[model samples]
Target: MSQNSLRVVWVYPDLLSTYGDQGNVLVLERRARQRRLDVQRVDIRSDQPIPTSGDIYLIGGGEDRPQRLAAERLRRDGGLNRAVANGAIVFSVCAGYQILGHEFINDLGQREQGLGLLDVISTRGEGERCVGDVLADIDDRLGLPPLTGFENHQGITHVGPNARPFARTRIGKGNGTGDGTEGAYNDTVFGTYMHGPVMARNPHISDLLIKLALDVNALPPVDDRWYEALRNERIAAATQPS
Candidate 1:
């Protein structure tokens, strides 16, 4: 209820933690501890019932089958949608991101239902997989640093009118189209394809999510010079031609 205490629900880690996405959960925990905030993480597996009242809900990337399975389980469990409706901060990446949209095409070229939390749709691309380092400028209003990460996905996501892009790509292909835009954001739900365990690379975004989860205007600061330096280095590297 207060900034002093928070709860995070990591959804289906076994199925959705590909590409070190579990690091996102660790980043949130570490950042919260650095600010002296008490945070508890609860993992909700496929067979478990999702808690409807967590402050933050984290869903990460997975392979096609796992992604479909996770989506199906979440649909049946039926807590995530209600939690988001109640203002819980939801962060999803890659396949997890796709699963939050209206629908996503699986590896078999079949359309699968999503949670419909974001007004976006992901379709399987016919060409090469978009895989590389990415640097994106976060929305200015969010007061966050540029996002840096690795993107490896074949699903090209298209954002609908109801949802806004979380950031604009500065380098590398985003949403698998070399588009200037990347990710999708609506209210408390954020869906992105960045998979350098995005939170570990963009701590400011993590902090912002924490603040949102706590319903606070601001949170205590933690030293981020190292993180900033790493981010800038990666951005510069990503922009350089091979």
Candidate 2:
């Protein structure tokens, strides 16, 4: 681990603080440190330029209005798409997921196009806001145990022609249909609605994300033992009712 290797950035357009998505960034840093990887964090605000060199980029969840506002800014600035195109592993959650796609329409009759990095569309409308601990049976591509996390989104996501669903719904919404829409992964980019600061508590997914970043850097897989341990503990704890 050297000063040059583990640089990661958190993009802050709006509501990053409100939803506590910053916790995900902390989780990434802590895990990286545990693996003896060097770490740097850059938080990008509206007026600031997004640095292109980071290995990973994080975008957190926010309110509907703020989501739209952030989308407008990123659409105008064009830095986010460039980072993704240049091979940075980007992970966006909830509203962040919505903005990474082609378009999003929230429950209040608001509609806006997103960065169009993915071939999915999100629309918030009349539906139960799926909340609480969620479970997704692991698909073969992820190659991890089943995923569990918190989901709080009014948006119903429908994967477009070019996209694939990351997990099938076992507990909550997986791909926006009644079966549930858990997340989407395309190449090195990951998007999802789940966040208990998802990567903080769910390190298995974090490892998957790190693998993507490592692929970009042509680095070998760092040991993922911690991710396995955390997943086992979280699953056991989840099984015990409060």
Candidate 3:
């Protein structure tokens, strides 16, 4: 988290880069650089070891097989947990989100252990997948605007006492836990189901990540007019999708 540069690690792109979740990293890098902050972006594939040197780490959505493989590889590699222990920030989506928890149902329908970075537990839900637009109110504590994006996961994640919900679902089945919660966050780990590459649809969230990573109260402003316009358009559609 140096003023000279911030390292952003993209984890398991070969496996977990689904649902345009890679945009989260792109937006993070863009915002930082636009503010004249240097960024060292590293794409760490599934086969390689994750590095603890990063200030922020990003994981994306993927199918069951890739998710299972990524979880296994990460748990074995041990760098992610070490990074978290060192206070590095993490943002994950869908399958990436699920595998950050204590455990998740794998492609074989067997229980696969997660990194335990998040205290939640994940299980594949029954019936239909939770797909299409999502509209949610972010946790009041974050004091952010409404969340608008897309959800297409069968994951039913239960937030344990150690963690809290990231948002409340106004539309679409988030977490599919029947609790109307959309995501989970604890300490430095954050996970969500919404995909419009999420941060691209909600630039404030990107700013939050940057601030947290830099351990700063605020970030230098970057142009967000385009991001705001997209967020407004999506929120309207999610509220009145026809």
Q: What lDDT does each candidate get?
A: 0.89, 0.75, 0.91
RMSD of each: 1.1, 3.1, 0.9
**Candidate 2 lDDT over residue span 1-242, tens digit each:** 23335788898744554567988888888777766676787889967777777788999889877887788878888887888878888888888888888899853577788888877888765767766767777668777778777777777887776767777767666556665557777886778887777776576676666656765333335666776677677666666675
Error of 1 at 184 (Å): 0.5
Give the clash total for candidate 3. Answer: 0
Q: Per-residue lDDT of 119-218 in model 1, one digit per residue for the tens?
A: 9999988898889999888878787878899999888899899998889998867787556778989879999999988988898878889888877888
How many backbone overlaps does candidate 1 show? 0
Off by over 4 Å in 2: 1-4, 106-108, 216-242
Cα error of candidate 3 at position 121, Å: 0.3
